[model samples]
Target: MCLQSDLVDADVDPAVIEATRSALHQQLEDAELIHQPDEAHLQTAKERSEQLNFAISSLRRQLDAQTRDVVAPRFDAIADTSPRVASLKASIDAITQLRESWARVHTINADIRSLKSERRRINKDIKEKSEQLKARQSLLGDLSTEFGRLLTSWNLPWVDTAVIDRDTFLPAVNGQPFESLQASGGGITTSVNLACSLTLLKFGLDHADVLVPSLLVIDSPRKAFGNNDSDRQRASEIYSRFRTLADAYGERLQLIIADNDPPPVTSDSFGKVEFDYDNPMVPGVSHPGPDHVSRLEETADE
Candidate 1:
């Protein structure tokens, strides 16, 4: 009976020890779940603490740079200075309008240069045109001489000779001013006009550089405008002179004389193309005759 009781006591002691160990293990697990940090959380908190320390160190270094040991009292003098005269001790991030304004100034200067160049070009053109005009007008003296010779040949009355006035480019009779020819009626006037026309013709034929074509067309020189029966001899003389020119220049000069009842001048140098009421310029058209005008005048007088 004593041995059985001792074995039972040994078994009870082992059960109490096991209960105490289980209770201590359960307390330790509860404390760990409530307050102890995990491995990943501890690593993240360490990295955050290191970043904060580095930021503090950087701030302290920046503060040291602004301390009295580095910055001098001379910087305080800028406080009383004007904005225009003040200078900065430290570089600052900035943008200003001066660079853009300078660019605009350059653009305006380029435009001015271009305008000056164009003005020079225009001045050159004006000078060249003026020179060309002066050159073309250099033959005025020779033209005046030819005009006087033609007036003498055509028998201008009451004048020893006539000259072309430089200012008006018209005839000046016997050293008279413009329009000073003492002539009445159409007789002397017609002679003067014929002489002027022939003078121009001769001048143009002589001067190839002049702006005159090598062509002339004289239409109806006898019927109405100044060529009467009294001036028939003079008109015939002019036609003979034309015949002489047509023979001299040949094909180089083209002289077309269209007179229905032509003056008494005939030559192989002048080709004849006659047109009457039958064979007209157009097939079914004809001009009203000079007699038609005279008849109308008679009716008006009535």
Candidate 2:
């Protein structure tokens, strides 16, 4: 019966099934069963059960083989023993480092670009400043030449050459700074100061845009000179120079000199304000005495 069931479940050909049924009938007489079924269906039912069990066992073996093939590598990776996975991790780390390096390189390039731009701007500024300095130096040179000429005209023959200091614009007399001759006392200092003032005046006259006023006030140019021939000569020379400058520039320049004694020149040629002992420049106002105040009051009453 089991054989017949096997044949039927296997879906064998009808000819094979008939052959199996005959074989099963012969074998069934020797077979055993716990619950004896009706003879006609017994073999078929047993065959069906056997075939189903064999098919399930075969499918279980195939499923186990497939699971081993697909899941063993994943288990090895979980165990941290897969070479392929380690190589992939290394590749990922290398790529990440390369990306970080690229970012740094990009930042460096941007900084270089910015610094280059700044350098160009700074260079341009430096060039402009240099040009301005050169122009100022040229102007100072011209002024120094004019100052030297004026100093020579004022009878300072020692001041043959004059140069302006680049930084201070102060005169250098005969290739020496003006301060070098400061030990020569007030005469030399006063004369140099006057020469510098006239130099500025000349520069202002030449350059219309210059803000220098056309007026100069000197207090006692001959104050340092004593009652000696050399001092008297120097005083005369200074006054003569002043008169010459006034004549050359005419009303365009104004020079006011205040001294205890006047220059040895005609007062008619130049304006003069004289102050003597009787008509003192500073005349103090006097208050009236008591008798004078009483006389004024009596006059007011009359």
Name the best candidate (by lDDT).
2
lDDT of each: 0.71, 0.77
lDDT of 2 by residue, 249-287 (tens): 788888888888978664333677777765655346554
Candidate 1 residue lDDT tens string, 1-302: 76554555545777778999999999999878755667568888999899999999998888878775645544554444545353331212122455577789899999999999999999999899888767655677677787777667755446596878878887777777546553542545555665666677777888877666777777665543455653676677778888888888788788877776755888888777777666766445565776655666888999
Q: Which stretches of candidate 2 lie over 4 Å from their true place?
A: 1-35, 38-46, 57-89, 157-160, 174-176, 208-213, 226-237, 240-253, 264-270, 278-302
Question: Which window of ten consecutive residues has the lowest lDDT sum in model 2?
Answer: 31-40
RMSD of every prediction: 13.6, 15.9
lDDT of 2 at 241: 72
Q: What TM-score would you give candidate 2 relative to the actual structure?
A: 0.61
